[model samples]
Structures are given as C-alpha cells and as structure tokens.
Target: MNLFVEGFAWIFDPANYSGGQGWIVRLLEQLAYTFGATAIALLIAVPLGYLVGHTGRGRDLAVSFSGGFRALPSLGVLILLGLGLGIGFKAPLLTFVIIAIPPILAGAYAGFEAVDRKTIDAARAVGMTEWQVVTRVEIPLGLPLLIGGIRSSLLQVVATATLAAYVSGGALGVFIFDAFATRNYPEALGASILVTALALVLEGIFALLQKLVVPRGVVAKELKDVRQRSSRPLAAAGVPAQEGK
Candidate 1:
C-alpha cells in the first residue's frame, strides 16, 4: 500500500541518519536503555531467584511478588518516577529496571525448580559439595530456562524503553511521538516498523543463544520425550504414529 511504501521510504531516508537525533542515534539510545536495565535487573533478580529455588524457601512469596510487580503499569510507574525524581534518564532507567525484573526472577527460580530432583540427589551422592552441585550440575541444567527468562526480560525492556522519550530520555519513541504531534504519519509508521524489526532481530539472536547454551544431550532427551508423548495417544487408539525428528 501507499502508506507502507511511504513509511519504508521515510525509514530509509538518508537525511534522517545524519543528525544527532537521527534514527541510528535513537536506536542506540534505546538499546542502551534496554541493556542497562536488563543487566541491573538480572543482578538483583538472579541471586534472589536462585536462593529461593535452591533452598525451596520463600518461593511462594517471590512468585507472589513477581506477579504483583508484573501487573504494575510501566507508563504509570514512569510517570510517577518522573513526577518524584523530575524527569530524566534516571526515571526511565528505574522504570525499565522495574519492568525487567519480574520475568528474569521468575525464569531463574523456575529454571532451578525444573531441574530433576533425582539428578541433584545423584550429584550429592557422588560426593559433590553443595556448592559444586549447584555450580556444575544445577546451573548448567537450568541454563535453558534461565536464558529463557533473560530473553523475556530483554524483550520487555526493549519494547518498554520506547516510553523513555516521554520522559525526555532519548529513544526511538521520540520519532513516533514527535511524528504524531506533528501529524507525520509516515514517520510514525516508519518508527513503529523499526521498533518491530528491532524486536524481531533481538528475538532471533536470543533464540540462537538459547540453542547454543542448552546442552546437546538435554536437547536430544527433550526431543525424544516429545516423540514418546506424541506416540502414546496413537498407540492407545491402535493407530500408527508419525515419526518425530
């Protein structure tokens, strides 16, 4: 359609890439906000999540807290922080940190919980110290889920960082908001397209990361389990089941 062409043309325009407030600068600013927030959130969430998961203590409380935290509106939080702290990068950073925490926390603890009890016990039986078991066995086995949590948190932060422009913190959202105020539909659409493309690219990168980090044996076993589960119903119904890859 004409709108899509106009939007794409606006995005690819050479003029938009030259200024300090250009697309590249805004894109980098957005990425900085997202990555910074994610790192901070991970530091705070991962240790607490691991402790709760490892000890099976305070898990319910942590889960409840994460649920409550996730329900808090990012925009509202940003607004309140801006009001109290007087709008700047600090408010947006804090807002992003808050938004990024819950998923990472939930993922880390859930990863810990998902590790097989038998495997953990076997590690203990093999004269592994508690620390050794956690470091060598648990963390490796739980890595997929941990990475999954990080991915979720990263995606959320990236998406929400767009709101940074609302608080005068630089981000790609400036294009969208500024365009709307000026009735520049092409620019607004272009910004949105860039945001979506960025998110998808990030997602693909993380997906590749997940694949690389998860153990090969674990991947094989999971695949086998899926195949077996799928065959069960067919067996009961006296029908041949298609083979799984």
Candidate 2:
C-alpha cells in the first residue's frame, strides 16, 4: 500500500531524527517504562511465584488471579489512572506493571510443576535440607521456566508501554497519537511500524537469553522428548530440562 511505502520513507527522513522527541528518544523512553514496570512486577511476582511453586499451596488461587490480571486492558487502565492521578509517569508505570504480572506468575508456578517429582524426592532422600533442595535442585531446574515468564512479561510490558503515550508522553506511541490527531496517515503508519519493530527487537533479545541460560546439549535431549511429556512446560520456558538432562 501507499501508506506502507510512505511510512518507510518517513522513517528515514533525516529531519525526523534530530529533535528531542526523535525516534531514538522515544524508543529509549519506551524502554525505560518497560524496564521499570518489569522490575517492579518482578519484585512482586517472582517471590509470590516462587513461593506458590515451591510450597505447592495456592496454585489454583495463583492461576485464577493471573487469569484475571491478564484480562485487564492496559490502555483502559492507563486512561482511568491518568484521569485520577493526572499526567505523570506514575500512572503509566503502574499500569504497565499491572499487565506484566500474570505471565511471570504463570511461568513461575508452571516451572516448578514442570520438574519431575521423583527428582525432588531423590534430593530429599540424600539428606538435603528443604532449603538446600530448593536452591540446589529445584531452582536451577526451574529457572528456565521462571525466565520464560519474565520474557513473556517483558513482551507484554513493552507493548503496553506504548500505551504510555496515551496517559502521558515521551514514548514512541506519542508519534502515532500526534499523527492521527492531525490526520497524518503516513506518519501514523510509520510510528506503528516503529513500535512493531521495537517489539520484534526485544523479542529476539529475550529469545537469545532463553537459549543462553540452558545447556545446548541438554536442551537437544529434551527437544526430542518434549512431545512425549503430557505436562511439560512450553519450550518458551527454556531448553535444558531436568527429567534426564
């Protein structure tokens, strides 16, 4: 379409790259919101997730809560918060964090559940303290799943951060909003393209992270048997598995 062509053209325009609100500036602001929200969510979710996973209590409750949390529309929450709190980073950051919690929570509990019970019993049989077993055996084996949750959370947070422009300003979403408000279709398309590309870049980064955390050899072994396991966590959780690896 003409809009796509024109949008690409607009993206490369040298004049658009120099201002304080330029692409790089906007991109950085989005990243800041993303990291801030995710960091906060990690603090809240990781411990809760780990506890629920390690103790095996309240998993049903956690799953139910996460499902509900995921249903909260980020932009809607941002608007409501923005109206009440006024234009500021607080509202947007809180909104992003709210949307970031679910996947991380899911990943945490699921990671623990993904581990073979026999492995855990074996560790306990060897006279390892509960803390030692958790730290030495379960945590390492479950880490990939926990990181997978973070990866999913980051993806959600980054995408939601774009809506930050709706409540405040300084993110790439600002361009799209400004362009549409003035009927600048090409610029709007360009801004949307930029946002999509940013998400893709981040997705690739996390994908590499998932791969790096687990050993390739172990991952290779699990990859062959993933289909055979009924309760196996998704590969997005990471590669090296505990069953045999």
Candidate 3:
C-alpha cells in the first residue's frame, strides 16, 4: 500500500529525525527503564531463585507467585500504578520489574535443580560445608540456566517497557500511540519495526552468551558416548564402528 510505504519512508528520513528530537530519545529512555527494572528484578530474583532452588523448599510457592506476577498485564498494572502513585517513571519502572521477575526466577530454579545429585552428595561426603557445596558445586553447575533466566528477563523487560508511554512515561510506544491517533501510519510501523529490531539484537547477544557459557566440548563428548553405546550392540554382532584418526 502507498500509505504504508510513505510511512516507512518517513521513519528513515534523517532530516526529520535529526537533532534527536524524535523516537531516538524515547527508545533510549525506554531501554534505560527496561534495563533498570530488569536489574532490580535480577537483584531480587537471582538470589532468591538460587536459595529456593538449592534448598528445594518453597520453590513451588515461588514458582506459583512468579507465574502469577508475570501474567499480570503490563498496561493494566502501569495504569493502576501510575494513577495510584501519581504517574511518572517510578510506577512504570516498578511495573516492568514485576514483568521481568518470573522468567529469571524460573530459570534460576531450573538451574539449581539441574545440578547433579551425586555431585552434591560427593561434595558433602568430602567434608565440604553447606556453603562450600552451594558456592563451589551447585552455583557453577547452575550458571548456564541462571544466565538463561537473566536473558529471558531482559527480553521481557525490553518488550514491556513500551507500555510506559501510556502513562506519559515516554517510550517507543508513545510514537506508536501518536501515530495510531493521528493516522500517521509511517511512525507506527517504524516504531514497531525498531522495537522488534531491538528485541532481536538482545536475543542475539544472549544466544552468544549461552554458547560461551555452555561447554560445547561436554555436549560433543556426551553425543560421542551415546553413539558409542548405540554402536556397541552392532559391534558385538560383527559390525564395527568407524575408526577415528
């Protein structure tokens, strides 16, 4: 459609968007808010997640609570908090923090659970203190999953922070809302595209992080062992596995 084309064209117009008087500020501000909220959420969620996951007590309760919190609508919570707290960055930031908690908590819990029981038992049997077992044994094992939770939380925060615009908190959503109101199709499309691009960038960074943290050698070794086992029956039956140099 010509209308859509024109709109996208305006978005790329550096002259119009020059002097940074346009969506750039909103994007940065929203990114800041989202990151800040996620930071706070991580502060609270990561430790609690580690503790609950390690102890195995109250984990179900935490999981249920985090799930409930995550399910709460961002706009609805923002509106209520903004209205109740007199509308500003504080309420929106808090609302985003709530949105960010669940994934990190869930991830952390999963990480803790993934630590090998036999490894834990061995640590205990070797006269390791509870603190040593957790710090030296459990946390290291859970780092991959814990990092996963942080990544999830980061992505969720980035997406939801757009809702800040609804309360005059100003974010990319503001541009989208303005475009919708004035029928400025270009701005709306542009804003959406930019937001999506930002999300993708965040996801890409986290993917690299996961690869860096998870030992590929371990995975490769495991796969090799599995293949060896599967070939054992064949080898016993006079079929040899391929030899490696």
Q: Please report the candidate that would top TM-score against the real structure.
A: 1
**Clashing residue pairs in candidate 2 (N, C-alpha, C atoms within 3 angstroms):** none
* TM-scores for every candidate against the unseen true structure: 0.91, 0.89, 0.85
| Candidate 1: stretches off by over 4 Å | 225-245
Tens-digit lDDT track of model 3 for 30-128: 789878988998898888888898899898798788767756777888899998987678888988888888888888888889777888999999999
- For each of the candidates, the C-alpha root-mean-square deviation to the true structure, in angstroms, is 4.2, 6.8, 4.8
lDDT of 2 at 37: 89
RMSD of 1: 4.2
Which 10 consecutive positions of candidate 2 have the poorest summed lDDT? 227-236
Order of quality (lDDT)? 1, 2, 3
Which structure is stronger by lDDT: 1 or 2? 1
Candidate closest to the true structure, highest lDDT: 1
Q: How good is model 2 by TM-score?
A: 0.89
**How high is the lDDT of residue 157 in model 2?**
82
